[model samples]
Target: MRGTDWLLLWTLSLLWGGSFLFVELALEALTPLTIVWARVALAALILGLALRLTGQGMPPRGLWPGLLVMGLLNNAIPFVLIVVAQTAITGALASVLNATTPIFTVIVAHLATRDERLSPAKLAGVGLGFAGVVVMMAAGRLEGAVPAMAACLAAALSYGFASVWGRRFRQAGLAPMATAFGQVVASTVLLAPIWLWVDRPWAMQAPGAVPVMAVLALAVLSTALAYLIYFRILARAGATAISLVTFLVPLSAAGLGWLVLGERLEPRHLLGLALILGGLALIDRARAARPA
Candidate 1:
């Protein structure tokens, strides 16, 4: 990966990391399903306008099925899982467990594709990254959060498959902006019935300005803008490099929580972050030598 790729990856990481913080805020007045719905639904609307302004046409008629599948894997399922997990765990810890996405991505890509084969360095990197999660979880005194942790890991698994699956849009000659818009729109369509059935959103009370604004940022800033950057990096850097952003996400989430929410950040958490960064460097080292 080049320096530019690293920069985009880190930028992507920060945007996604802020998702946990946004979820924290939105949860004050919304259900997990509702928040997840709004994140993708509103992002779909934002991206749709951008697509119109940029003169990007409708997605290929032949690709709707695949696009819907991509939306489910990449957005709907994991977003809900993470939001639900946040109900029981701190945003930082949820982000930490979310780091496991790369590990799962490595395994899934190995099984699903011939080109992005697994290697010792990638395996080592995954191990080291996950060890960071364990370390931070311990240091944060996070306990009795088994269900929450499980939800997060499930979300990570969803993301892992989504990374590999997303490669198709590039192969099909879709622009990142258009592709991002398509998937979120698909997500909105797919999730609409589910959210309506589960949340009965009409019956729910309005969440007021703060949470409303937080959800908008979560949708536009984190989901819409982030997916544009995501597909761009995936096109240039491949699934492995794109997925490495998860390892950095915890650090960003923790820092944001500390700064804004007054969440504690112990010295031990810093030590854990060191391990995560080392693991990401190892992943990058291998990517530098290997084919995308």
Candidate 2:
């Protein structure tokens, strides 16, 4: 990956890292489906306006099928799964499970694509990075959280497939912003009926100011803006590489806690950071050694 790709990856990590907090807050007054629906729906509206303001047209109709698949894999399924899992488990454990995305991506991409074959270095790096996440988060007992843990793992696997599947848009020369907008719009469309049936937002009391703000942040910053960077990195860095953002997400979350909540960074955090960075470097070096 290039320097810009790294920058985008870190930026995306920061954006998505905060999403766990947002979802937790939103859940105070909203159900999982309601939060997921509001996220994609409002993100769609924002991205649509962004498209119109930038004079970028809607994605061509031919791309609709792909967009819908992307929506399902990337947004609807994983978003709902993660949110629901968070209801049963701490976000730190969820994040640790989420970091397995790249491991799944590596395997999926190896079987599903001609390029991006699995490599020993990549495997080592993924293992090291995952260990780093476990160390940094100190993921505790899972005595009663098996289902939620499974949900998180399932979400990570969905994300893995989505990363590989999304490469088609880049191959087809779609702009990142347009692809982002289309997927979110498709997700909103897909979730609307389910949200109506399950959440019945019309009958429920309105959420409090904090929860409402959390939902808005989830939509605008985490969903809309984050997807823009996501697709860009996907186009530039390939699926397995982009999925490495999951490893960095915990670091970003830790940084945010330290900065915003005055949480002290422990020595384990530094050790974990070192291990994660080393893993990333090994992966990059492996990529660099590959023939063009």
Candidate 3:
């Protein structure tokens, strides 16, 4: 990766890492569904205007179905699960569990694709990754937080599926920006009814200024800007290099959680994080060694 790519990668990590913090703050005044809906809706509006400014048209009709599925897998499901999980766990712990995304991605790819089948190193990585989960689960169990921890892992699994599913957009020659826009648009559409039904914002009290600001920052900085930088890094450095951002996200989230939220992880949580990152390193190293 170039210096610019490195800088973008770090920025992307912070943006995404900060999402957990934003969601935690937003939950002070908003329901999970409402927060998720607002996030996709606001991000869709921003990305739509960006497309218009760039003179890029909407995606083809044939792509809408795939985009909707991408929205469901990548945005709607995971966003809700993470937010709900955050209701029971700290943003730092959630970020650490979210780091298991690549581990799930490797397993999903191995099961779903012919060419991306698991190698020996990848198998070891999978084992270590799950071991990390077990350790984390033990930590959570002590706190009666097992369900929340499981929810975070499930969200990571959804992200893993989305990563594989999104390859179709690339194969079909869609621009990353267009794919991102279509995705958030679809997510907004999908979440609107659920948000209305469950949240019934019409009857609810207005959120405070801080939660509103957190929601806005979550949408703009975390979702919109982060997606832009993510694709930029993916395009410039390729998937393997871009995956390195996963290693940085937890660190950023942990630091921000401690500094801003006064959140701290237990020793077991730290041990779990170490194991998970070690697993990711093995998986990434194996991928890097593969013939292009």
- Candidate 2 regions exceeding 4 Å error are 1-11, 126-143, 229-247, 257-281
Which residues of candidate 3, in runs, are more than 4 Å off? 142-144
Ranking by TM-score: 3, 1, 2
Q: Which candidate is the best by lDDT?
A: 3
For candidate 1, the 10 contiguous residues with the lowest summed lDDT are 136-145
Give the Cα error of residue 19 in candidate 2, in Å.
0.6
TM-score winner between 1 and 2, please give it: 1
* Model 1 Cα lDDT, one tens digit per residue, 109-148: 9899998787899888878877876776664434547677
Better of 1 and 3 by lDDT: 3
Ranking by lDDT: 3, 1, 2
RMSD of each: 3.1, 3.8, 1.2
Worst 10 residues of 3 by lDDT: 136-145
Task: Residues 69-106, candidate 2: write the lDDT tens digits.
Answer: 99999999999999999887656556656766766677
TM-score: model 1 vs. ground truth: 0.86
* lDDT string, candidate 3, 1-292, tens digits: 7899999999998999999999999999999998999999999999999889989888999999999999999999999999999999999999999999999999999999999999999999989988988887864554538988888999999999998999999999888999999999999999898889888899999999989999999999999899888887887889888889999999999999999999999888999999999999999999999998
Best by TM-score: 3
Question: How well does candidate 3 score on lDDT at residue 241?
Answer: 84
